[model samples]
Target: MSASTKPIGSARGPAGPLESRPVEDSGRRGLTDRVYEEIKALVMDHGIEPGARVGIESLARRLEVSPTPVREALARLESDGLVTKRSQAGYRATELLSVEGLVDLFDMRRLLEPRAAALAAVHATDEQLDHLETTVEGMRSHPVTGERYLVYRRFAALDQEFHDTLAAASGRPLLAQAVQRLHTHLHMFRLNTAPGDALTTVDEHDRVLRAVLRRNPDRAAEAMEQHLSGSWERHIAVMDGNPAKK
Candidate 1:
């Protein structure tokens, strides 16, 4: 049976249904950055299909920004692996991850994240643990609602912050950098989402957080491995003979 199909540890199963609210942007970022994030959101929410052309003029008109910022935003997205630039065709939304790419991504994550978790258990300060707690709280505070797209967006950001904090807690800059480069959670959101998936994710995170709080390196590593492995299986199951399926 698939790992995702297997029950997550009984202690860390899904909680009650999530009741998410619309994700609120604080409007703190500069215009260029905001434009970049908005366009990126369009791609991630599948508002723009994989491999479809991204017309800068149209985007600029919609966003009410100059074409310069739109072009700049596309260039930045290209670096994030979400946009691709064809030699003569300008930019298009990048294709979703292939099965092989998914395997490779999880493989690299398996190698790096567990080690980071183990180190985090050994080195995390009280302040770092509190920061981790804050991120998890954010996830739990917003339950899934009718705003599925917004729910996914909020969950993905919180998830990224959670992992990024965990990696930083390792006190090894290079190791943390490696984990950040994977962009595991961001890409995973691009794959598929089911109703209970967010709750399951929070439960899995709680396990890791508990282990870390106890400063148990072995348990922390084990929990991290299970989390990543479960995520892999869930994403793989959503593949309907394509990189991603709605």
Candidate 2:
């Protein structure tokens, strides 16, 4: 899609138009955040195709923002693994993870996330638990199908939020940061446009949430481990030319 065709401060995915924070109502930091979010949506929706060079001035013109905020947003996106900067080459959207990269990502997640779930089970506040439940419900609301990434962006976003929230609830800031740095959902969602296992994913999340809600660290860890293993298998199947069942 042409950058000029997209409206400033708004992004469209297959589901609908994603709302943006008004740049005029916020301070510098808020403006940067808005720019960051809009750019992220554009990248996620493939409006800015993967590996395409991102022109700061062009993006600024497209979003009707100054280059400052666009620069700041691109820096943040680089950290999020959604974009990358090259020496003397400026910024470009990062390519989707390879099969080997996916394997490595899941290996690290298997080590970290199960522990995070265990810790969250023991240390999470009631409010955090409530939020987790609400997020899962939100996922339920956005069922996945044989559609493009834009069509299931809400599900993808909620999936990220659920994991991020669980990681933070572990009461381990460093661990939470590590999990966030992985950007697992973003990379995985970008890996395949048609995700067919929405119901299975939601059910797996429900299992993890239930164990955490019950304050069962072992069970929570086990549930998380199972979920990750299952997820890895599902993605592997997709990569192998077979989509997982819905």
Candidate 3:
């Protein structure tokens, strides 16, 4: 998940020296972010056996950057309930994200997203619809990258954009803000483990767009639920793939 990746469109200087400029520092935040996103993305993408301990130093060294940002990113992941720190294990990814956890997340999305879409149906601009449609389209051609086992990092970015649009289309500042938080957390899960289960997701998003555009609240809600349910079953299958040890 680490690269001394140059800023967008910037030519890589001699590979030996990792540049450290204030402007570069601003850009390094981008790397730091990529570091975080990549690791988390790997978690979802690779389905790293949950509860497997991951070493920050190892990851930092592997990514080819300073450990400071990696530390910061891991802490943030801890806050999100995705990664945890144990006394001896250092930081390990959570393997068994419970079925209860999955069902709860789906419930929240079901309750909130439909309302948001219904609002958006009336309030959304044609421009917003066009923008969302574009983002949805981008997901189709997206590619996977980052550390081992976890590749959902790319799709995670796409999912975030889509839900944010869904909220913005609603045009209710308060609701959008609230939904944004939930969506962020939801994206964390959906994106984290999306790689292995993407075909189901592609079909899912296709249906969502069709329904949302039609401005059918019931249909949009149903589509969202169906998509998430498929995801939950996939995760449950993943969980069963490594049945609980006695």
Q: What is candidate 1's lDDT per residue for 61-180, written digit by digit as tens?
A: 666667877788899888778888989888888777888888899999999999999999999999999999998888887644432344567777888899999999999999999988
Give per-residue CA lDDT, model 3, range 7-84, as digits (tens).
211321121112232112346678777677656644543333355666777666656767887888888778656678
- How good is model 2 by TM-score? 0.80
Flag the better candidate by lDDT, 1 or 2.
Answer: 2
List the candidate 1 regions with Cα displacement exceeding 4 Å: 1-29, 86-89, 146-148, 240-246
Candidate 1: give the clashing pairs. 18-144, 19-143, 19-144, 20-143, 20-144, 20-145
* Minimal lDDT window, size 10, model 1: 3-12
Better of 1 and 3 by TM-score: 1
Best by lDDT: 2
Error of 1 at 62 (Å): 2.3
**Model-by-model lDDT, in order?**
0.76, 0.82, 0.62
Off by over 4 Å in 2: 1-34, 145-150, 242-246
- Summarize candidate 2's per-residue lDDT along 146-240 as a digit string, tens digits: 44554677898899999999999999999999998899988887666446688889999999999999999999999999999989888887788
**Model 3: how far residue 64 lies from native, Å:** 5.0
* Root-mean-square deviation of candidate 3: 7.9
In model 2, pairs of residues that clash are: none
